[model samples]
Target: MKNIKSLLLLLIITSFGFSSCQKDIVFVEGSGPGGTKPTTYTTKMSAKVDGVLVECEFAYAQQYTNPDGTKDIQIYGIKSAQSFILDFQNFKGVGTYNAADLISSGTYVSGVNDPFNNGHYAESGTIKVTTYNSKVIIGTFEFKAVNTIGEIKTITEGQFVISLEPIPGPTPGNTTTNITAKVDGVATDFTGQAAYVKSTLIGNVMTIVGTNGVKAITIAIYNYKGSGTYEIDIDAQGSYNEDQSQTGSYATENGVKTGKLIITSATSNTIKGTFEFTAPNMVSSLSTKKTITEGKFDMSYTTTTM
Candidate 1:
């Protein structure tokens, strides 16, 4: 009887221990019975906005190489009506970056109406990059941002795991292709896929287009010459389209010769230039214009005989 009781007690203890171990075992996202680990992970960003946790449904990172070989990195995430953005100038790999340094900054956008113009800019913050490489970027950030109207937000506990991919451009062996300008005093970065350069086989004509996914700026030069200033007149033209449908379009008046394009360097495969133009609204009968200034582009081109 004593041996039987001892064996039963041992079995109960072993059973309890096995149950506890099973409970403690945690499985990964796809490590269940019929699932396998995903080869690629999705980009993720999450943060607490004034104590409320929010996760971004879409997130992306873009790196732009400047003419001086410095790198500018922009990380963006969007969740519902809110958006978050971080800009790092002269990025030098894994390290802690502060917004007070004036080279790096953060932005928070709320509401869907006029998000671009109504967003808040970071007044103070710190971002610690734990891992940064060609494949991925992992970081934690927090900021105190203020809007134009002085509305403030405290964003905290921010974390991101962003996947990086090469940006395709016309340039061979070049991964960075972007155009930046100031439109009516507002800074704009044209880094979308639509930004490109196309030239004729004879190399007499060229058209360059850049967009920020919302607005597009186009420059067409006729009788193209190397390293020279071109007038925005009959020989060269400029246009600004506000939307994809191009319902609201603006163009420089022909023969008016209001703006100029200065080609600093024009090579067989690449072109570096600066341009500025005043384009009047073509869609509206009323007289309105957009001033594009400090425009710069360093891009490769694809030549066609047709």
Candidate 2:
């Protein structure tokens, strides 16, 4: 269940990152030379859970291709601490999928605990795909899920519009990539012609760097998994370099005790998250410290093989 939650968080973050910059590609369902665009068509998700309204502020879908050529589509809707997830395995085009078939399932997470244990898992449900293509998917669903305690949550009036266009990674010299944060309560923006952002994945470790042509921020994760909160220790590290000449400040064993990296989403080509750390100056003569807070990054990446 922990792994399930982590994977869901990862998918949500990745969907948010892709939706932020590539919202321009609009797909008019059934539109042609004489067809009128429908006003209700938009990328969103809304439903009723246990007779209460749940209009998700964040929604997205992901498709995975299996080794045997079968496909799976997972839809997610998140609102604060609540989330609704629907999964359809061995997906075939536009059709109706029933939970009784064992190829489809739905989950409703109402709190921080595992949905299957504390929340709910679909006991009966049906998902109907209305429109589907290489770039877009339209669907509706309803289900009744029961938790380990026998409490049931009924979900209905669910609908969603998911985009499937690929999101491209930042180019090596692209200065428009963004990474922002606060240094001691001062806003610091890294973008435009003054900044450069990049990431590299080698084996199970991933390193991310952002520079403003002068100062720089670097974060390294030793055992890179999908999405979750990571502590700054020997496994995870962060550093802030003020200039090219100094040894900089680091969130290492010799530094202060507070530091964390929260990865909201991560994939083979993209990553998004928040971070903060407190570090003492590496130079022994200087007793100064550097504190970074409210740090955030959303950018594509490249990978290097072993």
Candidate 3:
């Protein structure tokens, strides 16, 4: 969960990149509009110091297309700055990180810390890359901090490697179903126009469909209830679809999302549900279920903690 994309930072193969030497980076906070937009791209890197893991992330999900038409992602990071937050404050920087700044020219290990950020520090382990399907993953890097109080820390080494799949287009139905509703007892109209995507036989159980970003995405009503706890995560896939960050509605830190939804009411063309949010940064590894009978069947996802 914790946007474990940082673990899949398999850079280029040995033939496409420099020799197996230490890599240094010059991390610029932002390129243009300075906000949550990730300045890092196309590389993966991780660190483990002391005993904790200081995972670094790179925003390369928007880049690279494999011949099979999937996204082969890569992430990169900085050695001097393993984390973007400290001191009980979340300090998200403007970009990816630099490695050589903290490690020697050829060595794999590094000294990583942000002296001006939160007063927390650590000694980090080596960063490596692993290959999966059409993508190469990087990370499992650890950063063991000396101070745990008021600090952004990594307790263990974790890895999340997922291939960027293609989002199938909308399915065509003879009936044009419309849904209107208020969220969490609020009387506000839906934000963006919904998209009608044809559901792919993508997963094993849940016949997944639709996008849930700023765009008003039209998903085949999977589970509908008047009032209760619920959750959903909708996203575009691969280079074939537009980037979530570009629309500025990417859920939580990973751009995708995880949340609880509580429905208050529902009808023919109108429905209502209470929406709750969870940080998409880490995985969700728990079986939390809500039952709503007034609506249709149901759907769910597997996740860990953020």
Candidate 4:
């Protein structure tokens, strides 16, 4: 019994000695998602406010999928944001805003800041970010509006380069194609498709250039009135130049129209919805809302193990 007791005491002391001799440990790792991360992503975002062209950048170390199955972006509910300064031909500084001034302010909408009663901005409109990039070729860091005396103007549907970061690479999707524009019952000419689109994980922005005469259309998705589900809107160049003319023009097919796209359909690699060329106008003049009836777009996505 004494030997057993002694041995027990010895074991306890030995354990205490060993525990006291232990040292801290750590391990180094690779940057970002580590080496096992996927090279591509299936991305989507939403923005409110119709009849305007907004330019913003996105940066994210990760990506997300909304409950409604829509893709995710860095931020949403963009009231007024810009990415370039040179494009500010008509861009007036919304009153006097400092950087990061109105961030997270509130849900901004058209004519919200209009003191002029012109149904447009009463002063220089505010964008979340007002900066420039390598591919901006032209334009200022101002909000764009259709037929407004404000500094903001509309962008024809051609693709413009925004800033983004390059990953190792992505499984190249069709990056190039021609799409038809339908406003009401008129079929417009094919302008071009988004090409050379690179994703910037930092800013969470997707930058693309137009090809074969493709116009850049802003596909915005946002959660409004609820979560998961979103409201989608597309801003193109203009409407069918002569709505009644049998022949359509690129200007007509690729400009921003007063319309919204309700994402009624979605898939792993594609999103389908209604395209109404005239929305605000339909809401006012025709006492009607226009829907593309059979308009759809196929986009590519990359999913990874988060």
Q: What is the TM-score of each candidate against the true structure?
A: 0.44, 0.52, 0.25, 0.25
State the C-alpha lDDT per candidate.
0.67, 0.65, 0.29, 0.27
Each candidate's root-mean-square deviation in Å?
Answer: 24.1, 15.2, 17.5, 25.7
> Which residue runs does candidate 2 get wrong by more than 4 Å?
1-25, 28-40, 113-116, 167-306
For model 1, the superposed segments whose C-alpha errors exceed 4 Å read 1-40, 115-117, 166-306
Q: What would the C-alpha RMSD of candidate 2 be, to one decimal place?
A: 15.2
- In the range 53-102, model 3's lDDT, one tens digit per residue, is 55444212223333344332333333332332211112121213321223
- lDDT per residue (tens digit) for residues 212-287 in model 4: 2222223323112211232223232222222211122222122344444454555543444444434322112223
| Full candidate order by lDDT, most accurate first | 1, 2, 3, 4
lDDT of 2 by residue, 63-161 (tens): 665557788777877765577787888889898888535688888878543434546888888888998887777888889988888888999888877
Itemize residue pairs with steric clashes in candidate 1: none
Error of 2 at 78 (Å): 0.6
Which runs of model 3 end up more than 4 angstroms from their true locations? 1-123, 132-139, 145-149, 152-156, 167-306
Give per-candidate clash totals: 0, 0, 54, 45
Indicate the residue-level lDDT of 6 in model 3. 24
TM-score of 3: 0.25
- For candidate 2, the 10 contiguous residues with the lowest summed lDDT are 192-201
